[model samples]
Target: MPSTSTSLSPLSTGLARATAGLNLCHENASEVWHQRPPLDFLQIHPEHLIQEEGGTYRDQLDDLRHAYPIVLHGFGLSLGSCAPLDQDYLQLVKRVLKEHPEAFFSDHVSWSSLSHHHFHDLLPLVMNDETLDYLVERIDQAQELIGQPILLENISSYMRFRDSTYDEPSFINALTERTGAYVLMDVNNLWANAVNFGENPLTQLMEYRQSSVRGYHLAGCTRQQAGDGDVYIDYHGEAVHETVWDLYEKALRHFGPWPTLLEWENHVPPLERTLQEVSRITRYLNDLSVAPGAT
Candidate 1:
């Protein structure tokens, strides 16, 4: 049977103790396949592996599963859309999960579609009671269809709608409270928003519900010129910025150690460099685990 727990599944619970992992990407597949790194678990995008020639480890699901526990992180659910859930997309995800019922699933809280047209980008939602109600209904239906809870991730926002009634943290907490879903807190995205819009990461951490946050994502951003100032884009191309690491450490202190994944998709680096970043996450988690007053 598929996992139905609102909290972390058995595999995710075990991986939380393991501390760190990497987002499975085709660019690093050869090295990962030839010499399996010491990853706690692997996060895969179902869309990237739905076909035999999808280039995500070149259709080696069986071989990869033998080495590590898997988790599904999707990008096409478009949960924030006003339209009904995409049955075809859901079917592809269902097929993958049917084979690995032990895996947990996650997707962004932002919308990416308008009717039949897909934006191919994680667009921000207006944080209001109406939007929240809409998302709650959509998430409920999605959970029912998938037969498991999902971790709704915070996407990096370049701008905010003036009609927003609730801040990001409040909206996310309310979503989780209403739907019994978990939060895939992406610290890099938080930091990007902070850099772009003066949002305080420390304040957000305090405002967020710790119990709702079940996992984390760490990635790098690109700073580009915008108007007179600069904008920080969640590019995931370079190394983790120093400011992001600071925020990540603060998150660990706030939420305790959880399963964290390092995402390096753009300008994919060498496998060694990728593992090095994962090592940094492991180090942070280990430090937190051994800290004073730790559980």
Candidate 2:
């Protein structure tokens, strides 16, 4: 059976500090550590781990699993779509999990493709009673197929439906309450949505069922202003903003310390820079734990 718990070994604090200045794209992933920097966790995109020309991918995963704790973050599970679940994709995911028994498996809460049309980005779902019922049943089926509990991540969306009745937090809370699945909260996405949609992100966080959150995501974003409109995009490049850090601090206070992942997908910086961001978040987490009256 696939393992549900993360490993107990402490990430290399010294390596995390030493590479706190390196560029991410320039460095080869294989040479990420001269000293094997302590990583909080290494997240692999599921597609990257299991391609048809799968020899190198399998070898790399084998090497990675031996060195650090790994988590499988999938991009293709369209959990909220009206369409049926992709059995082939689920089978591949199951195979990967079977191979890496120690890794935690997770995917997004939003839907992607529908009716043979594939959208590369995670799109928002209409929040309603019908959608809620569909999601709960889908979550139950997915958990049974995967043979382990899956973490569903809240995704960033560029649009919302006028007909939608439920807000994001209430929808998520209801899903967790009914399905018993854990949440993978993405702080940058929440902040981006707040800036774009004029909703207070902190208020949404407060309304969420905190006990359902299993992990958190921190990423960099880009801000754009055109005419009277301004938007913050979850670009996952550059350094994380002060606003994101503040939100993360608030999240730590609300949900307590959970596994946090710093994502830098586009404009991959040096490994050191990524490590620095992770280090910074870790410092804040440590500080939060030591603060007076902190639980």
Candidate 3:
């Protein structure tokens, strides 16, 4: 049987205390239907769930929708691109949202396309005033078209732009302030960047300096030793690391809990193994949700 606990939103007090359950990728929908683990929600990638020939959604996902609440995580919104917003793609996304009006939508802060050509990766961005202004304008445009506010997630980057002005966290804080946007914090990504950039992960987050977390993302990345030193890759594969868990503990301690996600991007694990991971996370969340003050 599924746990009685429900997913917590940033607006909810419980979110501050943790207590949110597991949210898995749509690829695990079938497994979830069979196993019926205590899940909070299922995340659907827009890139994967395209419309059918009849202009309707893939009917197969209907079962998953009926089983659990869906949250839309976009890969191709390209809000960071210099090119104009892709109206056709946005319409498709809006249509899907209409089908599931209750679903929350989000995408990475990084650009995945340029000059109408997609790189298919969450490419890094410069955190200068120009980039900030560009992204804020596009976020406003995206929110207007989507008919709801959207969350922008921090993307893991291996390189930094020379033209960058403010730090990533500062830019995000300003971005949200300028556009009334929310954030989906990826702790692992921050940790990876910290490891690679020689900065403290907690300091990276604390610089945001506001409770701007609308959602949270957790995934594991492998570390490789290079000629220069060590570098961490945000591959979203493998099990969660203790260091990342420690960062998460600090995040929960400071910001409390928001709607958190466990991304099983590649090197997929079996359904049973995924279940064990979720159970472990749930126990941690349950322990943490009982914060300093509340019951």
Candidate 4:
């Protein structure tokens, strides 16, 4: 049977400490309470929550659970690598899930490490039958060990494999069908690919297995023009672009309102700006629900 004890530990400790009046102040209490309208979800890096200093990371996670729904978005899982998945990384992820029972976990579909050497970037995967089978088997093992289905996200790519046998949508559709895992569709990635590769991102997204998508991600990109070719990098440092916003609206129509996370990892802005962007996405989703002709 699945256990919540393993997942609820961190939240329990955090809540206890928070209630002890340690960080509370008269001026900030109302603001904190109002903004803390049950965070839809928070994606955390494993390094931030998994520490060598013993209980500090665990304690911090416990406190975060009190105010927000936590999701473990791994930066180093490297699911599509030809090399075997890291056993130590998998064990750490399991421990985190056990510590935050309320958390949902996910990782990128791209690989970051090859032959045990870490590249620190989400590298594109070759879409082929062999790679598909390998990923399906690994996902099966991961699910067996973790006792829950995992979610995978599509990654942006600058180059395509010469030998790719499947398109991005077909690859993701097949993997989800074979492994029964969910998806975290990143809107910015879709837009970036469409702009760079001349593929209709909405068409690719429409080909996805609708039942497999659990959430969506929105982030900013950096646009550059070099000679006659233009490129957009998924920088996550600024406000979302109009093209990405349009794609997000399409996603809202296709998938309904699910958990959405606005990623602002670089060029860290004021807290208010980040909050405002999140609020804008939230309102956009809300408006979609009420809009006529919306499915």
Question: Evaluated with lDDT, which candidate comes out highest?
Answer: 1
Candidate 2 lDDT tens digits, 58-131? 56555665576566788777898878888877777778777666555788878888896868889899988888
RMSD of each: 3.6, 6.0, 6.8, 7.6
**Best candidate per TM-score, number?**
1
What TM-score quantifies how close candidate 3 is to the native fold? 0.86
**Which stretch of 10 consecutive residues in model 4 shows the poorest summed lDDT?**
13-22
Tell how far residue 269 is off in model 4, in angstroms: 0.8
Kindly indicate the candidate among 2 and 4 with the higher lDDT.
Answer: 2
Q: Give the per-residue lDDT digits (tens) of candidate 1, residues 224-264.
A: 99999999999889999998899999888888777889999
Looking at candidate 3, what is the lDDT of residue 119? 88
Higher-TM-score candidate among 1 and 2? 1
Off by over 4 Å in 1: 1-14, 51-56
Candidate 4: TM-score? 0.82
Window of ten residues with lowest summed lDDT in model 2? 11-20
Error of 4 at 242 (Å): 1.3
- Model 4, 60-108: lDDT tens digits are 4455555665667777878887787777777877887887776567788
Question: Each candidate's TM vs. the true structure?
Answer: 0.91, 0.85, 0.86, 0.82
Error of 1 at 92 (Å): 3.7
In candidate 3, residue 289 scores what lDDT?
60
